[model samples]
Target: MTVNSANARIFGSDADAIYLAPIGTPLPTGIDSVLDPAFEDVGWLHSDGITEAFTGSKTEIRGHQGARVVRTRIETPGTTIGFHALESKAQTKGLRYDEKEVTVANGVRRTRRGAGQKVSARSVVVDVFDADDITVKERHVIERFEIVPDGDRVFTNSDIAGFPFLGEIIGDYITFESSGLATDTVWNVSVTGTPTGGTYALSVNDFSTAPLVYNAAASAVAAALNALAGVTGLSGITATGTSPTVITFPSAVTLAANGSALTGGTDPDAVASTTP
Candidate 1:
């Protein structure tokens, strides 16, 4: 968690929930500028597993989105009497995004339209925790981590020591990348454990041949996955059978920037990922 001098009192407390607990007689409401506040509103929304994230965040979650939990320790070990007492501690994760829309409302009959986006995230910082011995409670922060869809990684680890714990949370990090070849268009990615050595097959039925498609032959793409296997930089490309099981080849595939949604239910879980 990022820290600074502006919020030191609550620095060591594990950030839990974020709600504007207004401190005034006006019933503090959400302030737009420097004042004002309304009833408690959602300060953050995380998707550690299940969530329809149209924006961004960083989290290593599983099971149902927003159903997973991650705990962080803000209070340092060992405490003393009459020590520095925390007033309040809070954590926040910023979420940001953009979209197209109309700038102003009312005014002209035909107003020009514009583009825009919104960004927001949740924060998990320590709160006004007692400096003395109270109780060691594991503060869990719920967030989400996206695999960037295509070319997602596959690794080995423990239940809590899984790769997602170390991968998600970055708004820009790419979890998977082909050792060599990169495709500009895709849906999802899968890394099988079968290691095809060099042969592969495809579901020509999964793609649309309308207006003629690119490399219409599943055999051709499979051949490419095979041919590139032995070629420089293409060693990660592997060919498979009717249904790709385990294929290894060159590690050169562009995942996120080009991939769309997986077609025909291509399960990414079945693919066994590995290092380049």
Candidate 2:
């Protein structure tokens, strides 16, 4: 049996956060854009964690002659998010009581609920943190949803106040966007013959390095390549290994052979995603 630890990933909600905006507010352009000013962070949540529920109904089609179900059809597929806000602020309260009227007088906040009121749809963005608990791993965006209170508010000395609410997806369902991870370009640099002390030049992406000795160490070659000026994309390129020195770039880029001085360069794969 073989085990691969590289495929394992553990995610926690320690640094997770929820953001809410008006229905017409634009969704985040990318995972890094979740912090736009249009969205309001709902603050801390209960340790129970956020729940995403996908529900659907299935119907079986039966034939009278065979008396057996042949096909099954799904119906009313829906999605909802459940969370308990630990903060007792206006944002959470407004979500819980969508029809409540709020006013502030002398720095005193008051909310009043009215009869025969309707809940309004809102755009929600849920940020899930990575194992580091700081970087965003995945961003779940709901274009339009209605916040429905769980109608249960618990206030006790033993536990903190939790304002439970459910987000009923009204328009589009959840669209997931993840942070892009770029793989560095790598090249194997090999020296063919032993040179009796002569200077050689290395060129990468049209940028040439300063004069380097023919018998220079891999580390020295890496330093000379990294020290190349006037090219921003070529910065941070590294080299390692002996004979066939391995070079890596910060991003996918075209590599020049420098008249066969550097060879066997490979570009990183392109990032692609699809919407459901």
Candidate 3:
């Protein structure tokens, strides 16, 4: 392969997030800004981030002709995810010890470990964000897994308390669903009459574009809208065409009363699935 600098990319792990749901829950078919209510965000994790491990045993077959290995077979395939939680909430404690929290008082909660307690399995979803663009990300789904404590638990005032956890893969190990930038919301702008120079505003957030001439160029209008200040969640907005200039937004937005609303915008679809 030839070396290509354009294809090389570096990533950072700061914006990654993890979510947990009941085992056998249905996976989402499309990517959205917010996840379903069934999945609970795992909150802050250790700075070391999440780690994945694969383990298996292999057997080799030898041929009698030349005393050489001919074939090999893999047995006992396994996969696991390791991570440390920085929060000591009830949900985190429950996952670490396969126990539920029992309320003792208004602000007091406790968890007890008993003999022959079976570990609980959960569906895990890990969302990894792109360093360059946080909107683009990859969602890793594990159908069923058990969370086991990876190290001894020590509570002390001298150091920060961290809970180490290991997720054991049970069945249908992992699936990756990737998404690109969100669809852009569009609108067609039409100017009528002999109106003087003025600014155009969006009805949704009251975001107004810079001053524009009576019949300004589409590119100029796009540049003015893109330069709007104090607006949130309206990135990569653009404008095209001459008379009925079309404006596109990075995400959904409401058009002002003077323009025609742009349509045909949809969120990115999940690229992979493990189950129906």
Candidate 4:
């Protein structure tokens, strides 16, 4: 969620609905902005998984050829969100990209398939203290800062654990820029246990594809797993992850399956079923 000091509190404890506004459009006082809002009088945002998305042009040309004019037009997209969380959180003192520290034989930081995108992962210093770490929560001004995305690190000179630093400021609101671009529907499936070493077939959205052949090696499994991105019917589906790779499909897809001659590996599960 991109932060805006709008002083709005959406999804209150008793709220059965939400409000949405266009990008760059300011919402009313105490109202929050959702990803895609209705341009007509307020439309309903569903809590269920069903929706109707326009697949064609929403606006047409007007007047005759000599005096024709077309202003703004809305085109149908491939996917839509029935429900989404418009807000997110970042702990003042947690790891970047949420990587957990573990003690391996040589202090090497290895993560499971659930570790999140490696591009955003970084090691950090424990410079700040938490409430449990100290008796006082800083009775003074307990400074707050707006976090800059893709900027410098935070808490640089303070002897904190995670550093180099994304600089810090003194404020309560952290405003992040937002783009109206759409995101993909993704799911991560971990192939665990010993590989029986054989061919595995995959099925997506009821369309079956060729079998994926691999050995017991982890690298081999990861390679073959990612190759599913090119399947004919898989359209916008993309396969990612290592050890436990994720396959991101178009939001319209509802099912994906892996049937391999290999043994001991678990069936692919939705990314929601696993933590990242």
Candidate 5:
């Protein structure tokens, strides 16, 4: 199947779409003749965020597409944590699983420039017990989790030990992918804290338009996140640069539990203006 490089457009009827196509419709890859054995792993070849570059001019060389990178974000204050892939339950909060675990070997380099002809190799290992199940359900996760606070840099897709929401994004992963994908991605944020009475809004001017709401102190955090979904451009996002978007849950209660602070705002609450 062919895909567009910039717009990330998908062409050709894929297996996923062929069944939906007319019965006699022809598939580019002749996938229908193969019958069963539907390929153990199914990937839509969306913009895996992988890129294919063209050295030659646009006219002479073939076209390029089917490229994409995983977009990630964190709602917390520091860059310590980031896009991470968890295997089991140890790392995940809401989801139930055993624990997540991984291992790697490290070494120190002693380059010739460092007063030595050859570099020395030192060994170091890092492990996190986020998920480890010897007995129960065995699965693979493809979500993003980054402990940026630590020394780790970019998290690769191969490191995906297991799937998050069956590889669907949620939590911090949700905000990472949900952001509109033009200039930057959109991240509908969500925050939780003991309810308090004063009204609050997102801390930074991360979004193109600041959408802030404040009534009681409590309901502020969640409202700001929800406003991003329909927000038009990538310029309007929830998290500001290095700092995080903050929302103080409303402390006041309505008829029953604490009331929602995410109410009443202009049609578009200019980015950092409201709370959620």
Candidate 6:
């Protein structure tokens, strides 16, 4: 009698697919798979039983239909596993365990460079917790702690020690508007509080169009002046305003070669305006 062993083949005449290895085996390498393991461990099976199932569909990729496989492993008492897709093919796909922890001991801190540093969707949010209390100490972004980086800087609890306590750091909040620009015209402006008591030059004509309106010209002038890196050095000086007709500085600025006060009527349509 011929006996079938481990390679026994059993199929009906109308079999549509072939079954290979037993369940729970890792699939072959070529198959695309995503895996997100538990925070610290894996294989935390339910106390009851395991329910395994798989479904397939034809999804459109580019212009052609591609077969997509979705497999689900459900544990009793309802624990749904989540899987994160691998970034590239070079990396192996499998469960990802995130059980890392951070210790904090200083004031939870963050920094901002300028007025443009506003929290947005992509911003990384950190939450600090008191070690013994298990209560949340603070929830904030890096901006609330400091201002102006010489170049690029990272706001991290790891940088400081003592006081803040060992805590958790959660990340990446919702999205927001990153950048944009609005162009307007400014006809008149006044600048004051220069580091050196000398004339500083500004000209709005280069940004002006023909037959410029008074208010638009003022906006352009204010925006141009505020854009200068040196403008921040002029302590007590104000060169920006929403009212577009006139740009006012904290002090008087010379408009022409005669050292006249920079004002609306005296605003020259030339490229060189000076502040003293």
Best by TM-score: 3
lDDT of 3 by residue, 44-142 (tens): 888787888887789899999898999999888898888888888876777666454465677777656654334667888886766665555566777
Candidate 4 per-residue lDDT over residues 131-220, each given as its tens digit: 222211111111222222222333457532222213232323222221212345555554445465655544443344455553323344
Best lDDT among the predictions, by candidate number: 2
In model 3, which runs have C-alpha deviations exceeding 4 angstroms?
Answer: 4-12, 98-101, 115-118, 133-136, 156-159, 173-234, 241-276
List TM-scores for all candidates, in order. Answer: 0.17, 0.60, 0.63, 0.25, 0.15, 0.15
- Badly placed stretches (over 4 Å) of model 5 are 1-51, 54-205, 208-215, 230-276
* Candidate 6 C-alpha lDDT tens digits along 103-130: 3347542222233332111111222223
Query: Which ranking of candidates, highest lDDT first?
Result: 2, 3, 4, 1, 6, 5
50-150: candidate 5 lDDT, tens digit per residue = 12222222222333454433343333322111123233332222122222333334743222222212211111111111112111111112123221111
lDDT of 2: 0.66
RMSD of each: 23.0, 11.5, 9.3, 22.2, 22.8, 26.4
Worst 10 residues of 6 by lDDT: 88-97
User: Which portions of model 2 show Cα errors greater than 4 Å?
Assistant: 1-9, 98-100, 115-117, 132-136, 173-182, 185-276
Task: Note the Cα lDDT for every prediction shown.
Answer: 0.26, 0.66, 0.63, 0.33, 0.25, 0.25
User: Model 3: which ten-residue window has the lowest total lDDT?
Assistant: 267-276
lDDT of 1 at 227: 43
TM-score for candidate 4? 0.25
| Model 3 TM | 0.63
The better-scoring model by lDDT among 2 and 5 is 2
Count of residue pairs whose backbone atoms collide, per candidate: 74, 0, 1, 20, 73, 28
lDDT of 4 at 143: 23
